[model samples]
Target: MGDALDIMQIAGVGAAALVTEMTRSSWDSMRDAVARFFRRGGEERAEQELRLIDTARQRLVDNPESGRGPVEERLHRALAIQLEAFLQAYPDAAEELQVLTDRIQGTNEGDSGGRTTVHHNSDSQIVIAGGAINASGGFHYRAPEGGR
Candidate 1:
């Protein structure tokens, strides 16, 4: 909230929620709400952003089920960056973003039909359906002590 890193985290999580909502039946409502938030830039900027959002939605819609994981991940990352910049310019809007994030994620959670459950994980396995999972950076492993 008070620093760049915190803002980035909020933006990242918020963007993930937004992208996750894109595939839901209630997308239009959420999309319009997001556009309203972007209207801080101006009417024209808002329209342009909405078009980009529509294009991202189209990409999600066009991809086959199995191919959607990567596509969604890409879209989530892009939106996260955009949201981070927006928050940087308008720190006061973080609360508004929280409202959007809560609403979007709340609706998604309320729908139990499309939920995917993973049990007893032993490795890094990702099973993406129509939601966002934000993971960044990479893993580096080193043998403990003299084990290597």
Candidate 2:
């Protein structure tokens, strides 16, 4: 993550992974560490970012059966912005942030999670997608549950 774009991407992934994969016991500590890393400016911004992470985690925990695409996407985008700003203000921190990013990614990320993916060659090919497909070619997505 030496480059700005790579750093942003890694931070986004690391932030999302930390928020989603961490258990309740380790959550607080990891959140604090993340805040500390981004603590280039005042502590208020770091605290706000951590709070946002917490809120995102709560949403995923509350809706475990539902797809978290929206929450994840939003959190990733927000974290990416924060990371970009921090890196811009402190160019020397790219390597340090990369180390932290590696640590976050190294942790076992639990399951592959669940997703509703469609594959079709043409209108003639119908994807049943969690339910039996009818004769007509149409798309139906049933959210996956309990992790895949």
Candidate 3:
């Protein structure tokens, strides 16, 4: 909306949000936020965008392999193009687009609104509550390729 480069950058951020957040637990909220942004166009346009988002998510759910490969890249490009066109049509919505993108990034970073401190010495072991673990002064063994 501001310029060709700015619009493309905004679209890239939007597309990255869609692609990366689609498989995460926050996806429903992310999708709804995206729909709200698109709703600037109109009800019909918002619904159509929602459908496209859902279709992309469904593809990932139905075929997990595609989520990390060429299919994912294609989806990113498609969404970026769609968003760029939308921004071109509605130039004033660029600010809201940036806010939404920031929200997605913040959510992904686990916004707990507090500081977490970890104190560890060379021989210390630690485990955070949410699926994170560190073992110090030990031989580390990697898992097998196929979910061992």
TM-score of each: 0.72, 0.56, 0.71
Give the best candidate by TM-score: 1
- Among all windows of 10 consecutive residues in model 3, the one with the lowest summed lDDT is 122-131
lDDT, each prediction: 0.82, 0.64, 0.80
Per-residue CA lDDT of model 2 for 105-141, tens digit only, reads: 5554332233656666443433434323475765555
Candidate 1, position 116, lDDT? 74
lDDT of 1 by residue, 1-148 (tens): 3588888988999989987788878888888899888888789878987888799889998998788999999999988888888888888878888888998777777775575777886545455645455648754445458642
| Candidate 1: residue pairs that collide | none
* lDDT, residue 63, candidate 1: 92
TM-score of 1: 0.72
Q: Which prediction has the highest lDDT against the true structure?
A: 1
Q: Give the candidate order by descending lDDT.
A: 1, 3, 2
| Global CA lDDT computed for model 3 | 0.80
Decide which is better by TM-score, 1 or 3.
1
Candidate 1 vs candidate 3: the lDDT winner is 1
In the order shown, the candidates' Cα RMSDs to the true structure are 8.3, 10.4, 9.0
